[model samples]
Target chain A: MKRFQQNIRKVVPYVPGDQPDFPDMIKLNTNENPYPPAPEVQEVLAKSNAEQMRLYPDPTAHQLNAAIAEAYGVEEAQVFTGVGSDDVLAMIFQTFFNSDLPILFPDITYAFYPVWCDLFRIPYEVQPLNEKLEIVPEDYYKPNGGIVFPNPNAPTGIALPSAAIEEILQHNPESLVVVDEAYVDFGGETVLPLLKKYENLIMVQTFSKSRAMAGERIGFAIGSVELIKALHDVKYSFNSYTMNRSALDAGTAAVQNAAYLQETTARIVKTREHTKQVLAEMGFRFPDSKSNFLFVTHPDCDAHELFEALREAHIFVRWFDSPRIRNYLRITIGTDAQMESLFAFLRAYLKK
Target chain B: MKRFQQNIRKVVPYVPGDQPDFPDMIKLNTNENPYPPAPEVQEVLAKSNAEQMRLYPDPTAHQLNAAIAEAYGVEEAQVFTGVGSDDVLAMIFQTFFNSDLPILFPDITYAFYPVWCDLFRIPYEVQPLNEKLEIVPEDYYKPNGGIVFPNPNAPTGIALPSAAIEEILQHNPESLVVVDEAYVDFGGETVLPLLKKYENLIMVQTFSKSRAMAGERIGFAIGSVELIKALHDVKYSFNSYTMNRSALDAGTAAVQNAAYLQETTARIVKTREHTKQVLAEMGFRFPDSKSNFLFVTHPDCDAHELFEALREAHIFVRWFDSPRIRNYLRITIGTDAQMESLFAFLRAYLKK
Candidate 1:
């Protein structure tokens, strides 16, 4: 081995979902919204002068944060922005999870949680989800450094009520509770309003899913001014200009067109409901999902085989190889036409 | 006090230059390229479909990385891309500086160096520069966890010869050495070619400077495949997709226009030389700068007072409040017309 090689940090990186570049592929693996961003976003991108890129972007990302603050009816001081929600969550973990006690989250939640924990050297413990793939609020009532989880949990798509999440928040007044609402726009109830009452509550949202701007990479956190201030301090220490100027302008435009966000989210929810009925009739068992994706399993079919078969036919869906959820498939709700194509492929593959 | 507050990892954040947004401000505080980006970059941003932002960006940032690799005559695997050079350097520190030994750099260098060490819990010691503000190769011959310093080091703009930097690399074969070439395109001698001979060497460059895309936030590191691979692992562990689609497209276009880079760099170099001669005639004394900025001090004027005076007149230049550099000013080279305006202001202010 080379002499300097021994000092390298060794760890398994978080693997993102495969993004196969195919002209005809139905890309439903990463839970990206099928619809494009608001026309105002496109207009902003087109109208902004790229020559202005000679100057550094506003380090604080003021324009985008102001728009989010206005949209949420919060003071601008309550909002913190990053490259994406992943970056925001990573910063949150780095800043708040430094205590000796292990942070707590659901075992079957987002895989990136463990990766971030490992990166920051924060001890973490995963509470098991109930047999129905539901997060039990009581399970997180124990002592912990902090607690964080997706509201509509990934791979399962089962959402806890705002009251249930508030239950966990109430039990642990001294711990920070991060409510990641990445998919809340689709249907999940948000605990955002509770931020006015809970000092340690941080609600994270993304432009990736319902807002259909994942390619532009915008996400934000809203909380008490103190928490937001602390997060900003850590973020500034890490990277000053995470978001570029064009994306900031585009995000502002997207936030201003509030009707477009509502209409696109409603369209996706309609498709999700229709798809759920179709899957139930096809003998797939699953919980009532509130998010844009469905976690499902069949009595006789092997999930790994189904995953491979779908990929072979240019249809992509997420399937985890973990212990509890190995047999389940997580399918993102696409446009009606795209979902129809997926159903046709699944039917032939399963010999329905 | 809040109980959770005790666990928050706190540190003083790096203060970036004042980006005072005024319609008629001279704006020379941050070392941004005075010229705009290549016309190809503007065309690429305008022509790319913003509706395609519904999907996530290519996690690898393939097109931009490939362009940089091709431009530098290196294999694609030898390059690692990030949001900016700051992000790249932060990742490098997290990935490589894990040994018990303290890393070493000049006392007067980029302020972010010590900030990052504090954030990552790495021990570091600063070596004092010579009276000429030049880095002494022998000063870094001691043991270190790793070494990194900007070529044409910040605020001073005094660059070391290629042989001088190679001497440090030769002496510290067991430690990783990172050469930050953020300002090298102006006139500094780059050790980029030494990558073929040294496995522990990593050269970092940015589009924010000579390429004129600071607002786009694109930067990269070039080194051996093993070191680059390690960096990607840490970066992936932190955030899977740092670059958004539009910025990646813009960066690729910028890299492809090699003629524009050369032309812009030459223009800046010409302006810098002219400014240095003009400052010399105005009784200013400083090191011979090899960058797009001049680090200068006048015998009769206080740097802080001049900084404020310039600010009042809307001609922003950088002034550091450090021990040795408190009386020195760092002025970025602007257009010929802008420099003339600065000279005119200086002549009137100094009554020269």
Candidate 2:
């Protein structure tokens, strides 16, 4: 006799990436930015006062939205912000995807998508990734209430080119096409420019990845004014003030300091390239990554065994238990020094 | 054509309380605490670091939950926290309120309730308060999946006794009864003690009101472990990290400075009593308030006029547009100096 709704009763919550603590471990899991954000974020946080906290935060997140809108060359009316991309995605699931018609998404993308579908009682179909680990445009031509997938898809880091996504958008003119660009700035191109052509396209991006503000928990969506208005209606009806004052302040600073973000993202991308070369020299074959992480499986051992071996040598990398991805590991690109340590330890462990 | 589900197209977002700027004016709307929080909270804010912002916030808010549980004499498992009481209330709507069975709530309490019900597509019957503007326990005994209303009910500031609440809880054994005690610490008693006897009860509280951490946005729910688990699942699946690091730090500090909260709440309660007397002397009729605000109506003037009159005088209070309560003005009790100015301005406006 559970008092909750039957839909909620059956919901299995999304499991976030494993957060582990090992005193001397090299942590390359969870795909976090290896460097701190622009120093301006820290200064903004430092200047926040307790007196200001007595009043409610700006419900509109005005300044942050303005900066984001300016940076993206979009109107602030086209922007909607939330706690994170996960939060924004949750609202999208409830707002745009709750229908009798099935929603379409990649089977191998962010695992939270299925959990959200179950929670919202939205019928959905998993369009299996193609043999090359790509989202096939033809699969989405069939009727679906909506479409969503990461640009550089998670766990695999393979990017779906904007043209391929635009193809799906054109095919599914009546369905909402949501492109989650969580890892886009790392390598892939943004389809934000195509938004003018496709009024049904809603793009969600995060400061967590490119701007190194993951801990600050700021994510926003851009779309036609009508679509953004629907998102706003849902948000206001729900929490009203989803992001706090500090997050807004830090986020505004992060968006304004585009140079700092570009420098940090470029550095991480360069380090990822170097790490891939080192792995290739050690005869390890991994997917060509367009994001901050690499998906790799070694011929010398089982993926889980390699994960354990690296753990024993004080290196932490992500390993999903789902059957399809169990054979591979997702490794976040670390700093030059951290990657040096990771490479040295991996070489020693693979030699066994 | 738009791609959003039909259900979302009809959701009208709630209008938040006005946050007007009159730098030198007395502000009283929104029930914000008149005094700043303890200096310890400020100390905690000053010490917040960029490093803490790098790692995600503790998803479960373990440390703050421990403090709240200890203060309320409950097990940590009995608690769940969110961005604010509004956020906690939103999750409760999605978690326990959805059913084939129609829900029931007061027509005049917490204007946001209907918005949530509409957004979630939950069928609900609005239960009207008694002639005296009180929530009658008997009104809730009719068929309902769950019950929810504010303690020291909003706008009107009338509270239902615990025994009356117990009667409704006893009648609805198979449903969840949610008591929002957002303003309980101002004067009303908390029903947290009922958690032991009633497994179906969910009590929502917040730091925003009594603890003066409104801008920081921290709130929690206390229920039986099963109910808390349901909320935990909803939170995890939707927004894994609702509270940011600074909130966790400041909330813990606010609770730790118990003496400050006690002293401040006592002062506000005293001011509320004095304000009630002043209203009575001015030939106004109002309900006896148990919260930090007063609900008053005068025979000689319009509530809207009074609201505008106060606004012109650089004072502010809340006015709702509902037909039943349109004649009443909800004024938040503020510091003695502020209230004195308000009274003086009111007397001049009335005579004019």
Candidate 3:
């Protein structure tokens, strides 16, 4: 029986945030936007021709690519889109990181990185973040196959300056440096303009975070034309019609409505700052987060205890049991009203 | 510059048929359904809550999986869905075909099989189809890592009996045998019932051909609980949120309207039989086709010449320049009116 089950490709899967279905739960575990997508996106979905779905979608995703390229001030050939940034990042790993040398990433960054490395059989090394949970630029000056990390590093929500990113890019000219900007829209500055200066920089962003289309599964990478072409080559080989028709239409509409994106992201930033001030008064310590989430740790209370207590109160937030970060809890910035409810629960729980 | 891309993972990408924008053109190139999907699918698209797009889609795809399982008379755990059958098949290859022995498939089958083998760095053997382009069951009775081939195999449109498939399955008990049924809905009888008997058998099907949801991109696999679990394991490791929210909604609606699937497929089969008779009278030779498309060759006319002539006349059909099938043209079954137009064009060209 064991012999019959030969050649199973096994890896420990990445566990995403819990999406509970309780109506009363103030869901904030995943960093999804509190507001709805742009009105234009809804309009496009309503008006889209269902008859066109009988035919295959455009495998090249031309219109959406054009919209993204125009929005980012780059040529269409410099953009590559996929189901999500995870898909984009996976393709990048397959296309560029085929050498025997270990790929480099921060130990405390997005958990999906190591899973992709294992999936693609790429050797990788995780450089530990400093005591402050900030990425050390000089730590990555060593020889490596390639490099990748989220811009506003996950869980911690601490972002490195453009100068630090530039220093890493300057030090590693031969290897491709992928800056996953999945959370850059809230307040983190983009390295998109750095494309003109560095050809090896692949900037991956997602409509899931900023454009509020996570359910629609739209992510893209912008880089040199050569790099984009390579990603397309691998994508075309794997699955040409990755982005379905509805996703293409909705994503393009979201990209076009620049005002809605700015308004919603600004609101989230405002709410995040307000939450930070309140948490500071509550004796919670955290880094100044540029992304929409805050990594908080209360010195007097246990994170696991707080996570359970919040769950009991129907206020869900992320808690990782991994080493080093087990003591901390990551809270996604929700609407002002939802944040108030969360604070109300926390204040009462702490008194107990 | 060459040093920058030291390990570029390159494979020959599969060339999908031309999706041209000519208004008057009859598209019989790719195997897309000529009819629109069920009205309920359109209704779902219209009424879907765009506000839900802000949240991440259900990673387990519980609703869509349940819909598919119910339609196929299987447990939800026995089913796995993806972007398309291509995506599902690719995941299957990654999960099950990771051994030292070479996997086996027919040489003249879906071209994507070898492309996937190359992409995954898996060793494979392309067994030659018999002179009639039929899969010989005896040829597969050898030691192998795994097996996969399209039923009513592509570009030939000839289906083997379920008995032959069972013989192959019985012989290769230790290996996982994947039967891709992309074109089964038109006429080919499915071996889905074999799932109860063979634990190592995986049957992959797509909505692209039968349900007319190609642009929406939904495909699924039905297998034993263990095999399906293995696929989910790989999928979760690769991309947890592979399917978008709209795809889930649209695909569920499609499966529920089983009557539409049957009616459209029956209409296609009726037209295919009529077209086969006409082509036979016009000196074209082909095997008895049990799929939605016909693989045909003319005795006196050059297949390439006919292909070009039909293209010039705004009637598109697929022509492969491969070694064995270079003289063959695969024509997808369209509406009766479209097929009439195709016949009219061929009549004038053959006369000329």
Candidate 4:
């Protein structure tokens, strides 16, 4: 081996949900919205539109930032966008998690957090969730580097209320508290109102979920002007033109068409409620999920076996193999017809 | 200021060429392609084409990678794609330059090189180019962290032969040598054929220049399978889905249309030769550039003054304010009609 090969950075990457390309498959592995992006997004996707692709996109992405600011009732200086939520969060980890102390996160949370910590060489400690699989906000009042958690915690989609997040922010005024509201549009309450109140608070959201543009790859953060500016500084240093021309144009349209977002997320919430009743009837237990997916565990079935069986049938769903969550399966909310198919399969399998 | 503010990572970002929004402008700045992408790109860009916006794009971006490999005559395992050359280069820095010794590069290279070193916290030494503004291959034969330089060596527009690059690669068997072929399609000699011979060699190319998709933001690297694997490990660790759906589809089409790439780049080379004669007749001195742009100095006019004058006339070109390049203006070759307009303004302005 070459001597310089030892200097190569070794890492274990986070595995995303499977995007199998087969016909007549039910894809509920990833929590993508089951609806297309807004008609405005489609209009901007027209070939005649965005023809200036020969040139680099505006390095600042002013039009997109401006549209997001206007839609969210924030100033343009308070907004920052990137390739995806993963890109945005990675930048945040690089910009804010440089302290000597270890940052804190929920023990069972979005899987990418620890991966990011290792990538940036940041020290981190995962605080365990309480008996009910929900974050104990009081546990975060200790001295630490920083704190970030998805608002409606993943794998078990129980959301902490805005008051609880505000309490944590109040207790640790010196810490950077990031609220990743990736699924808030489904049903979780957002602390977006607290962004202006707390100097250290940043709320990140994405069109990948409710606005239904996961294929387009757009995510953003809203915070104090100072914090956003700091993020922009690091972003420009890494890559000046990140969000491409089509992404900028389509994202702007998605953010402005607020009514479409509300309508689509409402449909998912309805499907989620119906699916919840069906799972309860089938003897499944789970926390009351506020997001678009349910973390379900059956009383008599093996999660991995069920995951395999469904995969064989061209149906896909997420089942984390981590220790505490091994018995559970995370199923995203799809259409009424798709949910009925899932119910039928579960009923037949349980009977057998 | 809050105590946590001290932990914030601060950096001075790179300043890209100005993208002014105006009417009837001759834009020669930033060196974007003067032609639109291939017609197949337009077909894939239809509003109804990428209708799977709700579904996450394939995390591996297999279709695009496979197409790139087949077109470039490399194995798919030896290829990696990202948002742009900047994104690819930034990831390369994070993955490879992790040693104690500083890396090496020419002093007058791509402006983003030093910015990346600062952002990634990699120590680096700048080996000054000789008086003629060309990279001397022997200067890179030092014990260092790694090495990377644009083949044509930006803002100077002078290219070295592949044999010269092979000399540096052979001398530094233990050091990683990255030959950025960003401007290769126009005329620069690419070191792609040497990938199998040197395991430490990586050749980076982008769609921003000759492919005419800067707004789409696609860049890739071809290297040894082991090195490519290392890059993918870091990229997956950072952001799994960087290339959007349209980008992947359009990039795959652009790579497959080899005839279009050759035809368009040939047109630019013709225009560049004609512009060189015009500039030389007007007493402008420059290197015999092989890339799409020319770095020229005029005896009577100030570079910054010429920049402002061109801007006032709604014409834009690049002028670096750094010490050695301060007297030179880097003009991008445009269409025949656009070149005539630039000459008309220059002749009228120079007379006064």
The most accurate candidate by lDDT is: 3
Better lDDT candidate (2, 3): 3
Per-candidate local distance difference test: 0.90, 0.84, 0.90, 0.89
Candidate 4, B1-352: lDDT as tens digits: 8866887887875454588878788889889899888878887787434358888888787899999999989999999999899888988988999889999999999988888888778999999999899898889988989999998889888999999999998899999999999899888898988987999999999999999999999999999999988999887775788889889988898899999999999999999999999988888889888888999899999999999999999989988879998989999999999999988888988899
**Backbone N/Cα/C clashes per model:** 0, 0, 0, 0
Worst 10 residues of 1 chain A by lDDT: A10-19
Model 1 misplaced stretches (Cα beyond 4 Å): A13-16, B13-16
What ranking emerges by lDDT with the best candidate at the front?
A: 3, 1, 4, 2
Mind giving the per-residue lDDT tens digits that candidate 1 earns over A1-352?
Answer: 7557999998785555587989989988999988899998888887768779999999888889999999999999999998889988989999888899999999999888998887778999999999888999999999999999998988788899988988998999999999999989878999888999999899999999888999999999999998898888888875778899978998998988899999988999999999989888888889898899999998889999999989998899988889998999999999999999988877776685
Q: In angstroms, how far off is A42's CA in candidate 4?
A: 1.6
lDDT of 3 at A224: 93
**Model 1: lDDT of residue A321:** 83
Better of 1 and 3 by DockQ: 1
Q: Point out the worst 10-residue segment of candidate 2 chain B by lDDT.
A: B1-10
Model 4 chain B worst lDDT window (10 residues): B43-52
lDDT of 1 by residue, B1-352 (tens): 6668888878675554577988888988899999999999889888767779999999988898999999999999999998989988988999999999999988999988998898888999999988989888898999899999999898799999999989999999999999999999988888788999999999999999999999999999999999999988878766788899988999999999999999999999999899989999999998999888999999999999999999999999998879988999999999999999999999998994
Please provide, for model 4 over A1-352, each residue's C-alpha lDDT reduced to its tens digit, 9 standing for 90 to 100.
7867998987875555577878899989999787788988888887434347788999898999999999999999999998888889989999988898999999999988998897678999999999889999989999999999998998799999999999999988999999999999988999889987998988999889999999989999999999998899888776788888889988898899989888989999999999999999999999999999999999899999999998888879998879898999999999899899899889988999
Q: What TM-score quantifies how close candidate 2 is to the native fold?
A: 0.95
True contacts kept of 2: 0.48
Give candidate 2 regions above 4 Å deviation: A1-8, A13-17, A312-314, B2-8, B13-15
The lDDT, on a scale of 0 to 1, for candidate 2 is 0.84
Which prediction has the highest DockQ against the true structure?
1
